[model samples]
Structure formats: C-alpha cells, structure tokens
Target: MRDINVSTEAHILEAAFAVFSQNPGASLADVAKHAGVGRATLHRHFAGRDDLIVALTLTAAQELDEAVETATAHCQTYTHALEVALGAILPLAARHMFLATEPAINDPRVAEVYASQTRDLTHDIDMAKAEGAFDPHVPTEWIVQAYDNLIYAGWAMVAAGDATPKQAAALAWRTLTQGTGNDAPSARNPWHPH
Candidate 1:
C-alpha cells in the first residue's frame, strides 16, 4: 500500500513536470488528468497548483544538483566537466526553463541550488584557465552565461526533434569552444597561445 502511494506521488510529480512545462498556468486538475489520478488523489499529494509547482522546482534543483555531483566525479578536465554536466542536464533543461520563469521560483532554496552550481562553474573556470584551456581575458561569468544559453538552445533543439541530446550537447560544446570565426591562430582563437 505504501509503495503504491509513493509511486502514485512520483507519477503525479512527473506528470506535473510535463504538463506544466508545456503550460505553466495548467491547473491541478490538468495535472491530475495527466497523471490519470482523481482530483482527490492529486490533492492528497499536493494541496494545490502552487504546491505542485514548488515541488517541481525543488525536484529540478535536486536533479541538477545530483547531475553536477555525478559529472564532477567522472570528469578530469573542466571542459569535460562542463560537457558531462550539460549532457546530464539536457533532459531537465526545459522543465527548469519553465520553472525558472515562474515568480515563486525566487525561493532562497532554489537560489542556493544555483549558487552551488555557480561555485562549481567558478572552480572549473579557474582550473581551465590554469590549464590554458580557456581564454584568460574572458570573464568567468560570461563563459558561464554562454554555456548556460547554449544548454537551453540545445534543449530547444532536442525538444523540437531537430537533434538528439548527444548531438545537441556536442554542438553546444563545439560552438562554445570554437566559434564560427576564421580558424587562423590569432587573438580570436580560443586556443591562442598566451
């Protein structure tokens, strides 16, 4: 009985993620219908729509946190770390994009999740700079923002069925590490010798 209830709750949360990602203003009944659960059952797990959105946001933060940890563990270089993390997060990117646009997403708990990521990104940027893998003059924040924007763009491509997740991640990595400019070894080259 307990296992079934737990499973039902999990189902509802996942359903909410899908429905809300497509439409943030979707109601609890929409989630309940999507989950194939009665309204009563949905309410039993989440008091209301706001409660469910919060749960979804927290779930996204938790998933991102776990992905970062996993990527960190398996990565040697900072580029590898960022690539792995981008791959880890590609699936959740859309849901997060939706949740982040919500007003209530400013919750400090969510901020902490992003703050932790910022710290990891800062560490990786410093490490990459030390190894001469990234241009020293580029601000860490700009690189992070560029990486983040690419992740979202990659997610959009995947969501539109334009590319597989792996392909999208690869493209994002390539675009970030190598721009469309001339490949001549000059100041424009990311790998230009310092």
Candidate 2:
C-alpha cells in the first residue's frame, strides 16, 4: 500500500513537470488536471508550485549525474567521457522544458541546484584537464564558468523563442567544445604524455 502511494506520488510529480514545463506559472489545479489526480490528492503530496519545482530541479540534477555516470562508465579519456555525459543530458533537455524559465527564478533552491551542477561540472573540468583535453591557455575556473554559462545560454535562447531545444543543445555543444577543447591533441595526452 505504501509502495502504491509512493508510485502515484511519483507519477503526479512527473505529470507536474510536464505541465509546468508548458506553463511555468501553472497552478496546482492545472497540475492536477495533467496528473489526472484530484486537487486534494495533488495537495496531499506536492502542496505547491515551489515544492513541485524543487522536485523537478532535483530530478534534472539526478538525470545529469546519471548521464555523467554512463558517460564515464567505459571512459578511458576525460574528453570522451564528458562528451558521453553531454549526450546523456540531451534527452533531459528535450523533455524538461521548464529549465528554460527556471534560471530566472530567485528561489534558494534555484541557486542550490545551480551550485550543485557547478560542482559536478567543475569535477568534469578537472578530469578533462588531467586528460589534457582543455586549452592550456584557459584557466580551469574559466572553463567551468563557460560550461555553466553555456547551459544558461541554451535555456535563454529557448526562452526567447530564438531556437528549439535541439538547436540550443547543438549550439551549446559547439560553444563548450570550442571554448575549452584542446587546441592540439598532439600537444599532450595526459594518459600517454611522452
């Protein structure tokens, strides 16, 4: 019985994310309709938009972490690993359209999630550096900041309706790689720097 209730709650939150992505300002009633749940039931669980949004953000963070995990699973090199991780996040971006609007939020959870992702990205930057994937001319901090900015820029472009999520993602890939990718793969391969 507890498991069933938990399942239903999870489904409702997924539905909430789907609805909120389409309508960032949607109310609980709106999410209830999307979740196919009564308003009372939705409130019994989520209670409010802030709760729902925080859950959605955390879901996204989990997805990103999983992406990194999968990417690093067979990873022999950091550059290849980061690329794989980015590939994993592609689907997340396509589905979680709410991320386009959430960066503008002043909520502490918003900042909290941002900081968490920053830490993860910095870890990747460090790995990439150790693997000799970064431009020697760039500071690791600058590379990390660029990666974070790229995420926001992709979301911003989607928010402005200048591009679709697919396009923003492609541009993000290009921007991040161009900004941080090693200028000469021959200069050094940390795995085999002779």
Candidate 3:
C-alpha cells in the first residue's frame, strides 16, 4: 500500500513538473490529466498549487545538490568539474528552470536551499578562478549569473529542438570558455583584422 502511494505521488510530481514547466498557469486538472490520475489523487498528495510547487522546488534542489556533488567528485580540474556539472545540470532544466522566475522561490524553504546552493557555487567559482580555470578579472557574481543564464539558454535550445542536451552542454561550455568569436584568419568579421 505504501509503495503504491509512493509511486502515485512520484507520478503526480513528474506530471506537475511537465505541466507547470510549460505553462506556469496550468491548473491542477492539467497535472491530473498528464499524470493519468484523478483530481482527487493530486489533491491527496498536494493540498494546493502552492503545496505542489514547494514539493517540486524541494525535489529540484535535492537533484541539483546531488548533481553538483557527483560532478565535483573524482574530477581532477575545476574546468572538468564545471563541464561535468553543466552536463549534469542541463538535463534538469525542464525540471527546475521554472523555479527561476516562480514566486515559489520566495518561499522560506526554497529560499534556504537556493541560498546554500548559491554559496557553494560561489565558493566553486572562487576556486575555479584561483586555479586559472575561469577568468580572474571577472567578478565572481557576474560569472555565477552568466553560468545560470547559459544553463537557461542551453535548456531553451534543447526544448526548441535546436540541439540535443549533450550538444547544448558542449556549446554552453565552449561559449563560456571561448566566447562567440572566430579567430581564424579566413573568417570574415569586422572585429578580426588580417
């Protein structure tokens, strides 16, 4: 009985992520339809939209924490760590990107987790700069914001069928490290002088 309830709850959460991610204004009925569960089932698990959003936010936070931990583990260089982290995180865009602009983020529980994650990410950015993996001249806060925006862009590309998740991750890493420039002598660009 407990196992069945757990499965049902997970299904509902997955449906909620899909529905809410695409349409933040989607109703609980939409989630119920997506999950193939009745409206009562969703309400049984989540008392209201706020309750469901909180659950999703917490789940996303836990997934992100795990991804960062796994990416940092066994990586010899900060560059590699960042790449691995991007690869791990880009796929989760659909699951968490909505939280970026969601009012639910202002919730105390969501804010606490996000604050901790930011602190950890800031520490990693500082270490990356010290190790010469990231530009030392750039502000750490700017780098953090850029990293986040890049993740969103990568997700958008993937969502739009412009690139696979792996391709998007690679492109994001390249854009971050190399910028959008062609230094080849044959390349035609006003910015480049022969």
What global local distance difference test value does model 3 have? 0.81
List model 1 lDDT by residue over 1-194, tens digit each. 99999999999999988888888788888989999999999999988877777777778878887877876796778767777877788766566767756755466776776788778788886777666766666667777778878988988887778988788988888887764213335655454445
Looking at candidate 3, the ten consecutive residues that score lowest on lDDT are 180-189
Instruction: Go through the candidates in order and give the C-alpha RMSD of each one to the true structure.
Output: 4.1, 5.9, 5.5
Model 1: colliding residue pairs:
none
* Candidate 2 off by > 4 Å: 103-116, 154-170, 184-194
Give per-residue CA lDDT, model 3, range 171-190, as digits (tens).
99888766422232334333
The model with the greatest TM-score is: 3
lDDT (0-100) at residue 83 of candidate 1?
A: 71
Q: Give, for candidate 1, the lowest lDDT window spanning 10 residues.
A: 179-188
lDDT of 1: 0.77
* Model 3 TM-score, 2 decimals: 0.81
Instruction: Name model 1 segments beyond 4 Å from true.
Output: 1-7, 22-25, 93-97, 179-194
Instruction: Give the best candidate by lDDT.
Output: 3
Instruction: State how far residue 165 of model 1 sits from its true place (Å).
Output: 0.9
Checking candidate 2 for backbone clashes, the offending pairs are: none
Better of 2 and 3 by lDDT: 3
